[model samples]
Target chain A: MRLDQIRPGHVFLLVLILGATLWYLLDTLDTSRRLTNTILVVPLAILVFAAGAFELIREILRARADPTTLEQRDVDEDQDSDQTPVDMLRGVVLLGFTGLLVFFYPRLGFDLAVFLFIFASLVMLEPRGYLAKAAFAAIFTLIVLGGARIILPYPMPTLIL
Target chain B: MLDTTAFSGALALLGSDINIWLVIIPGLMIGLVAGSIAGVSNTMAMAICLPLTLYMDFLPAIMFLTAIFTGGGFGGAVTSILMGIPGTTSSVATTFDGYPMARKGLHNEALGVALMASVVGVLIGYVILLLVVAPLGAWVIRLGPAEMLLIALWGMSMIAALGGNSLARGLIAGAFGLLLGTVGMNTAGHIRGTADIPFLLDGIPLIPAMMGMFAASQLFTLIGSGYLIKDKTARRADYGKVLSGFFQVLRYPVFQLRGTLIGVFVGAIPGVGSSVGNLIAYAQAKRTDRDSESYGKGNPKGVMAAESANSSSEGGSMVTMLALGLPGGGGTAMLLAAFAMHNVTGGPSFIDQNMDIVYTIILGNFAQAVLLLFVGLGFLAIAGNIVKVPITWLIPSVMVLALIGAFAVTGDQAGPITLFFFAGLGWLMKRYDYPVAACVVGLLLGRMVESELIRTWQISGGGELEFFLNRPVALVFAALLVLSLLQPAITNYLRARRARQQD
Candidate 1:
């Protein structure tokens, strides 16, 4: 089980969990020396860190045993066997679009941000459906915006309806 | 248990109100719509309509609210089946098998199975509620924090059973979720993981986080797919298939009964409600079934188990609300508010003096359950068409709806931010072959686990072993938890021994 055999993404996730748990446990201790405050957090943090390390070791062993086994193990229901780099890029782009939509929700407003996000997403996902995409983007934005306005008690920040 | 005079009086009260009958359909529709949408909870719907009930008579108001409760039970299953998004936390387990069925082009059957199970579950829940409300309420009140801790632990065990292929990954995900759940304010007034965010004070909002994990993440993964159902010819929604799915529930009578019983009992416990009931039922179904391997991959029994338990939980929750004036969850809390509005308090006196009213509410829910079958069928007819939409269009549209839904849930930018963050996390977990469901369950139960664990600790005077020794109920639950945890291993060992004998 060598470090080179480890997938960076898997290791990062494991480390993230272990690090977050450790930080949370320490933070709870910082907040209070009371046993109640740290009781569950301390034990839970230890369990997660322990599990994360064990998983990392197992992944390394499995990778060392059969390199392809690690790759096969990583492929889940979300990914197809023939998924290409382009598909991965598309997923990342779609995720980026979502992130930007949330980031600009207060700035650009719900209506405008959502409309632009939908329009851009549709165009990106279906490159040949400009007319349909625009129409859908408009209609969906209107329906969602209108429905939210009616249903939600709180007023949403909006540039225009 | 039957009081003849009260029974007659209940029948008379139900007959006296024509508006009660009129509000049932609308209430059901509101619930169905609210429950189908990812962010709008049935409690929210009922709260929105609470003012409308102020104008109605007491009986009508109660009926209207209960109708919403009954309808929302099945409504959440709609999106859960067609998409992986659970409209409410109660419907989370439903998505395990329901979404897979939709992916496999069995959306109609899944919808049918969920609808029928919900209807029957409500009927069974109310029947048991009617017979045992007084006794059940009394017993539920006796359960302490130690018992609750055990129950939460019981729910947490589902993470182990659901940890698909890797128990280590599952434990990590669940523990991480538990940590996230405890973020914000501890019951002891200590805040741990908020990192200075004001919204973190309430802990991470559960619904928005859930939408991100299950819906947004799943949508991200479906980016390159053409449609939800990959098989082009199998994409159409068939009413006949839905009816077949409806009748198919009849085949799993034992499973349905088990789920309903679990729902009622678990739901009767205040604060636990249908969310945990559905998970426990799904896990039990998976544990007991011969073809358990097919679960989480589109098993109809999984859908049936989840829907039945969650739906039946309404009755279980009502036991606490009506008999103890305690709200089991948010939905029942709204019902309690409605009770206060009507100038009617629930508890021993309310039941003792107004047994007829109690019977009327129970009888009214029975009618609502039966009517749900017909009304839910129409709703499913429309929602089941989601399979026909292309993935390109559906993905962006649903994502936008989910983001807005998250906003609605949180009433601020925090909701969308949490949704996005959890979405990325969920995608990574899903991509790495980790069971996102385990993590979701952890997040859902985390705060409760912490609070209960804290209470149990305080009650025990710093975790003395003598405290558990004194608590018979907690000890029983503890034993059950141990058994539940070991069930998988025991089953595997038995199967292996049987194979050796045959060989």
Candidate 2:
């Protein structure tokens, strides 16, 4: 079977790999290897994976008898079947916009970059009223920048200079 | 352990230190405002406030941090009650009772209950801190990675409670979180999934990823959910009735003590925080309520149980961190880092050596509770006005703040990048009707769990599960895990059978 086909097996494989990786890393640390930290991780990982596997197998089993499971059918029927391309496109756009903001943040300066990112994200969400959008953006920017200056010491490097 | 001198000194610092108070007050106010807004969280508020603490003295910095935490906890209930949308995960339980009460036009009463319960809960937790910090500290210190791993898994089991009816989907989301947690370099001295990116070396910061998962995803949902109704009709409850509400909460001694105890214990566990405290307390209250059917409606008892319990968790969580030097929750982890940066370490030794500081921190939580009662009540109206801020503007503002916080935490764009990654995943979990809390818990505990499991395997000579069965304590815990997983399904099955029989 393909890896995804045997869902629980895939989970076990992942857990095993993750467990091995952590063990290797912890060995390299110079600190006291507290017995609890060293010895208890294996069972815990095994238990989590086992629980997850059981849940997955049960779900698959239930799905197998889809016609017989009237309750399951009823519940599934209530679930939204109409996932729009617009939502998918919107997700892509959100991901892209976030990437662009991070990319330009160093060059554009903290204030400008943050402002643009906020403004773009808001506009994309399509909040009502232009005035509401502008006012919120300005107010939020002021509070954050002003709060940082007065209360926190995190220097916002400016590109203006 | 009861460092009276330190407690007094901390109080003196609060009263006399003009500069620290200045930082504390504003930070508290900002955190309150941020936490009250739908889609904003205490974690997000603290992350935003973190950069401000960088320049201050350690005491003042710590004071400001805890103040935000205290204020944010109360602030979350405001939106939860008024708009039927939880301001933070902690308030998710609050909405069950608080919103219903609000709908009945007893908004003031609900607010009063929440504020009073929060204060009482904090006091109970502080008392525990004063009495048993050292003993508890020593005990927790003895807990190895093996035990910590079990505890973290216990915390993750909260996903079952949070996941609602779909345990499978919830575990899947949790599994996804575990996968994301492994994206950085592993404990094995080798990078696993960094894809050769240098910034991924340090791993993702908890705060930024959480801000994205909780805040950004909420913004997405808000867009889809559409506009919230304005609650201008809100009437102030008789301010005098605040005492009456407190009395009402006290009358139920069992509820108060049980919820507070739950809060303290849950709070002591690393990775579990107020959100779980509220959830567990609410569930417990429901089970214990004589009129259990009245729960999830306008039950003031539910409000008291959840709000008080959540507030208490802060006190319990802080004590464990100070005594053990092991961070029990996100807030304490931040506190731990702050101490390390200042060349200070907290643990049993710290309590013994610097009794004054430890006492002062404990006193601060008590003082914070008292302060929250008065300030939260007095400014409810002004704070509630935050909801009037249009969603269009509010969304952008929050995005900017979350973006800044994310970037600051990582000192690079990767922080914000992780936000998008998690936010997308968060949105999917929501869309699929899965539990977001499970994902958060899983992500938080993934590393600790993975490392401990690996270590345990090595110790067991890389073999047989029989070793877990050998240790009596581990075996008992293992048995409990099985029972916990099965209990829900069995209960539901029995309930269904009963209904059929009745028919």
Candidate 3:
């Protein structure tokens, strides 16, 4: 329950998953109480939420019990905090650019969207030699277009998206 | 069961097909490249390539898809070894040791061992199929919904995944996954967790979600690194090491044979496929090894066990499909779809009537296994260069390909959206030390679990729980489930008893 005990990643997931589960459960109030609704979805969702919630409680409680040697549970094993500002910006930029690409993808078509996404992503990654990056992106685009046209059986592998 | 007529018929089928050869190499390559990509699976590759089979005859069509399935078996292993990312559910267990080996600069040997084990595993599975498919088919059919439920439950118990890190954490992850899986719908046509989103009515897009969780999240971990392989010498891509690793599989005969047996039997069960087979095979290997301490820390035997079982499951799944009209897993499900497209039926009667055609498909896959050895080497030699790519470029480029692949699956923004959502979820889960493999397994089996539970309940005479009491196969599975559930406790008790006796 203590806010200090939780990490940002956990907070994000707990809020997202719990919010969605509750939102769906509440939406069912408009419908009839069917077996699938009650016996299946409600209990399963609650159990999943409870499982995650329980783990958090256990961590906090265990941390409190061992007060003699305090260890901060703030570090994510996969994340490295000691980084240049540029390294941090690369992640943020890559994520934001991908979101934009996904949003624009419906209108631009697959080829244009993917080409732009790749080019922008490469540039944002701050690769050396701008011309080489552009050429690399162009070659990758051509290969993708060729593969989509010739190999895949879909009628519009690139065009549909 | 092989009459002279059927033997000659199989020979004629093989001799008459030039189209078969054309599709074989392409299909294998497609499966390999796609499966080796972090998030894309053999099933996804097979699904995309399934339409190509429509233009061919029935036997060749079956052969082509199975070739892809077979090649993907190893293709997935390659990525798992070199990249610390499992290419598919089956390759999840491969990472327990394969990735460790890669980190230790043993990636070449790991890849070679995986390839060798897969080739041998596929060969063994078909050999078993050739011998006992009729009898095995008949027996496999006797397994009802209850048995199927037990099989699914058995898969759910693969919580000792990633080398028994933390059983509690694994179970929580699996439970969380199963919940996500049951989100979209119930058999009664009610959408459960759509939250008024129409796109979610079909449930979460599995492939995209999987791509995000496995590929994107793992890429995030390597964001600051320069290359996949840290050692300078390992980056050279030596064929000599590859050959040595290929032969190293011979040194682990016990692991190979045990994994092969486990693969075929578990893989033959409908609804459970190599996803369970690879995990169970790896778990068993870990449990029984004399040098168990070395298991999760770069053991070649672990790679062999996982790769062998997953690849050979191709034969195992084929047995279930051809003889029972049931899909053994996702890959077999695609094969069954091809069967329908070619206007061919699969089941007991299909085999009885077309014994020659059945044998022909089996024989064709055997040759495909031998060809996989050569083709895999050529493929790996090129794909191995991925480790040399700078991490910054690698992450974004691969992520883009993964996004495109996701789009290709659902043909809409739903795919890419799901991919990103799951990638974030996967990142959080990974950050918090939950087993993503357990979650993926749960997602794969959650719907099946619900359906079979409903069927069991309905057939139990309006909620009478005693319906399972009289079924022999169900009883056997029930017993096995109990034993599996108690295995750790039982082992501990025995170990304690021996220690007390020594005192």
Candidate with best TM-score: 1
Which of 1 and 3 is ahead in lDDT?
1
Candidate 3: residue A22 Cα off by (Å): 3.4
Please give the range of 10 consecutive residues that has the lowest summed lDDT in model 2 chain B: B225-234
Candidate 1 local lDDT, B1-503, one digit each (tens): 87779989999988887998999999999999999998988999998999999999988998999999888989999988888999799999999999999888888899999999999999999999989889998999999999998888889877876888877888888888888999999888898899999999999999989999997557777877788888888787788999999899999999999999999999999989999999999998888788989999999999999999999999999999988999999999999999999898989888889989899999999999999999998887787778888888898889888888898888899999999999888987877777899899999999999999999899899899998999898888899878866777798899999999999
Residue B190 Cα positional deviation in candidate 2, in Å, after optimal superposition: 5.0
Candidates' lDDT values, in order?
A: 0.88, 0.65, 0.77
lDDT of 3 by residue, A1-161 (tens): 44554455665666676676667666654454866455555675666577657766666664455444444443333344334557656765776777777777667766777778878887777666778877877788778656755644444435533
Better of 2 and 3 by lDDT: 3
From the highest lDDT down, the ranking of the candidates is: 1, 3, 2
Interface quality of candidate 2 as DockQ: 0.18
Candidate 2, which segments miss by more than 4 Å at Cα? A1-99, A113-139, A149-161, B1-69, B72-114, B188-190, B224-226, B230-256, B269-310, B317-365, B460-503
Report the alpha-carbon TM-score of model 2 versus the true structure.
0.68
Complex DockQ, candidate 3: 0.39
Look at candidate 2 and tell me the lDDT of residue B135.
80
Better of 1 and 3 by DockQ: 1
Task: Show model 1 residue runs off by greater than 4 Å.
Answer: A1-6, A58-82, B487-503
**Model 3 / residue B141 / CA error / Å:** 2.4
